[model samples]
Target chain A: MSKAIITRNLTKRFGDFIATNAITFDVEQGEIFGFLGANGAGKTTAMRMLCGLLKPSSGEATVAGFNIFTQTEQVKRRIGYMSQKFSLYEDLTVKENIRFYGGIYGLSHQQIKSKTEELLGKLQLQQEAGQLVSSLPLGWKQKLSFSIAVLHNPSIVFLDEPTGGVDPITRRQFWDLIYEAADRGVTIFVTTHYMDEAEYCNRISIMVDGKIKALDTPAKLKEQYQAASMNDVFLQLARAKPGENNSSS
Target chain B: MQPIVIENVHKRFGDVKALHDISFSVEQGELFGLIGPDGAGKSTLFRILATLLLADQGSAFVNGLHVVKDYKAIRRQVGYMPGRFSLYQDLTIEENLNFFATIFKTSVEENYDLIKDIYEQIAPFKGRPAGKLSGGMKQKLALCCALVHKPAVLFLDEPTTGVDPVSRKEFWEMLQRLRQKGIPILVSTPYMDEAMLCDRVALIQKGEIMQINTPGNIVKSYGKKIWAMRADNMFRLIRDLRAFEGTDSCFAFGEYLHVTLHVPVEKVQAYLTPLQHGNLVIKPAQPGIEDAFMQLMQEQNETV
Candidate 1:
């Protein structure tokens, strides 16, 4: 399989402190990679660098077959990003929000029109296409944001805690959409607080204090760590006092 | 005597029925959980029970005193932690804790034993601004502040929603310890897995109680024999399983699809025989609290 993303010694430093300390990993195309870590564990720093939003202090990487350093704009065009906090524009109608995102992704008007129809049908929001985003339920808005992110058919999509505070049924539906996107050959990079969500990924990487402490399939990680679940595995790696287990990488 | 009792509680905010005919009782020394997703009325109900809001049509009691009638007494007897961090972010950790202690007319030293384990963890950063602390540390400080007054009962609303997994685990452990001390804790969370940690949980939706029982009993009551099914194309498998006549219900669980079959395993396999090109794998699966909750929610939706 082709690699969608690759990084070698990815390091992001702030003054004397390193936020992301020489982490290295590769993500294969069409893979759903779960990035797990406690808060302040450098996952955000690493993700920003990967997305070409933040310049790496020291690293070598490629995203969507483009060098992150030399071709940062190319890398940006090939990926979609959705954060948990940014619900679609509350004042805009569903269709209007879709149109805005499509325009930002540089899709043609003709392409955007067809994509808007397809998205409404796919999300079962035909009746809501003209409704203000705030009028829809939390679940609908969340699903819409995800669809809008992948509207331009980007090579990869980054979801930062997409299912936070959502109901179980909506969460289940969200995972189905994730599977659908992955089936369409789009790589998914997601960070979540829910351990169960971690188990859904093809492979997961657990970061602890600026380092990847464990990276493997959930099953293998559980077996290797002799833990019952990802929560236990996470606790085993991160339960230590802050900065106690920082090894010089 | 019951520590908390909510009887026929009905609350509405303008055009929205925030809570509907909600009623439940929490025993003294019991760790009770109000489990539900967002917009489930957990916060409204919590506010009423915490004496912060009054139910429109029903009565709520804290330590056997009326919420509206004895609001002052209830406020004194309960420690309330709102969903968001309610601490003074601009103040130092020590200052914030001391402020809350002052509100209850008690010093931190008076209740040091109650919040000592939690406060001591953040004590090293006592002089640091509350906003400067990390998420986990902020949560710990918030818990410390809540417990500083050492009330008879505690109300924590979605305390672990945005917290990290490791910190969430530690926070639950702290709740367990607090339970052992017989404080009669009332907590709410959106996480289904955390429902299992409570002694008894009330599953709420649309401001109504769906089910109230022990997590173990809830799973045991799931009458269907679940199967963990997976294939090469999970996206297609979910649609196909849902369309099958013999399928009772199917939902994605992790990498596999959890299907409750109306027929025998062999017949279900036979039905999937046509989709063998996808290399479908099927096996018996254990039903978790989440499964039970989903089943109940589906039933509720269908009835509506």
Candidate 2:
């Protein structure tokens, strides 16, 4: 019931360039939160800060009940992250990748073996566990990545465009796994350019020009903008005239 | 002759069967859509129709020419824009368009009108590297290069996926204008709302077509008792109403939680008391393409 992630004026800057301006938001426990924006809209920056990979410039954020500035290690320990291209080692078998990820998370040998079985069973990848990851289809690779991310049983998992180029059916099946994770009380924080995938999140926060433009349930944001769909919600807030270049704020 | 037609199509990549006995025909001058999420065989089907890939077992024709037998002819009559920015990112916009035009044995001046409307927007920046352009600009450039050849059938794979909403709207408008020229356009999208923009769409999932219907007909076929409810605390309202006896399905749609009734609407009082007391406004609602697709998905799952 407590806030899994809370931010106050969280900002991230690379040199003088502000990737994320002074922004504030909170992600609740067990909520599937969608962090959305165009390619360079600071969603990734904010998420990196939460994941403890990036520190804020002049703000504070608490992720997984740990102060990001002082307790980054604890924050990292309690959360999982899957990047946009989080494919497992292609040459390794499916079970091997799970074991590797499980090992990195500090699970015991027996524990890793059991969890590997568990993940394969959940993903229906048990029969293909011995096959090389490269041989598996992209859809299966996505499921495997998520399985490894959550195999450690982290309270919060961050997924960045986990289904970027996969087919729609695979994307749908991948989302079903995400929903299952949330149902099991794993708070999901995900970023995606796919508007339809954004709709799958319980609530979405849209970023434009390094600022949070709209933050609410996909439905609420759609109505507030009077747009027909999330794509419209994004359009209304992100409509910059031609020649108006974003100053990389 | 149909601009595109597929009969008993089957495709596989290695051991993975990507498309199953898929069959469909797209008429000339129609804005047909292939709607699905990832891994729905939309791309596979597009590749087969484009004649860029061969179907393990099937036959297809584009503009009355066989895909396998007359691939060279089909290539000349099709404009294919892949989902990704598959153009030469290092080249200038003008260069990319010119390159595609030249490949078709044509010149920029030859088919300038085909791309003029889209090109005008980027004319000043024509010398800019394609990669330097914004998502919207890149999208317009991709369209220009694809159309510079002035093909009869245009295939766009999720053309508006990553671009902003305004550009998506603009891109669809451009397609409509091209349709006026009687170019049979085929586009794919993961977003359900875009389905409404097409004349007819095939709702596909898992290498199969769920429904092939006009978006209007798809929404109309969802003959369910639907209502929209909203309040200051809409999230809580959704949670609370889901437990209401008459509530069958409650999905967040637009300003309200679209609630489908398990019972008749006249017996609404049994449910509205708690909702009204919670300061929520409830009204009857119409289903959209998404709702239709979702219902169809559930029905398909139940049957399968």
* Candidate 2 Cα misplacement greater than 4 A, ranges: A1-18, A26-32, A54-62, A65-75, A89-94, A113-144, A162-187, A193-204, A214-233, A244-249, B223-285, B298-304
lDDT (10s digit) by residue, model 1, range B132-249 = 7777787778888888989899999999987787788888999998988889999999999999999999999888899999989999999888899888766778888888898988
Query: Which tens-of-lDDT digit does each residue in B122-225 have in candidate 2?
Result: 88888888887777788889999889988989999989876555667888999999999899998999877789999999998778888898999889889897
Q: Estimate each model's TM-score.
A: 0.95, 0.80
Give the DockQ-based CAPRI class for model 2.
incorrect
What DockQ does model 1 achieve? 0.52
lDDT of 1 at A127: 91
As a whole number from 0 to 100, the lDDT of residue A213 in candidate 2 is 82
Best by DockQ: 1
Tens-digit lDDT string for candidate 1 (A41-63): 88888898899898999989999
DockQ of each two-chain model:
0.52, 0.23
Q: Candidate 1, overall lDDT?
A: 0.88
In angstroms, the error of model 1 at A52 is 1.9
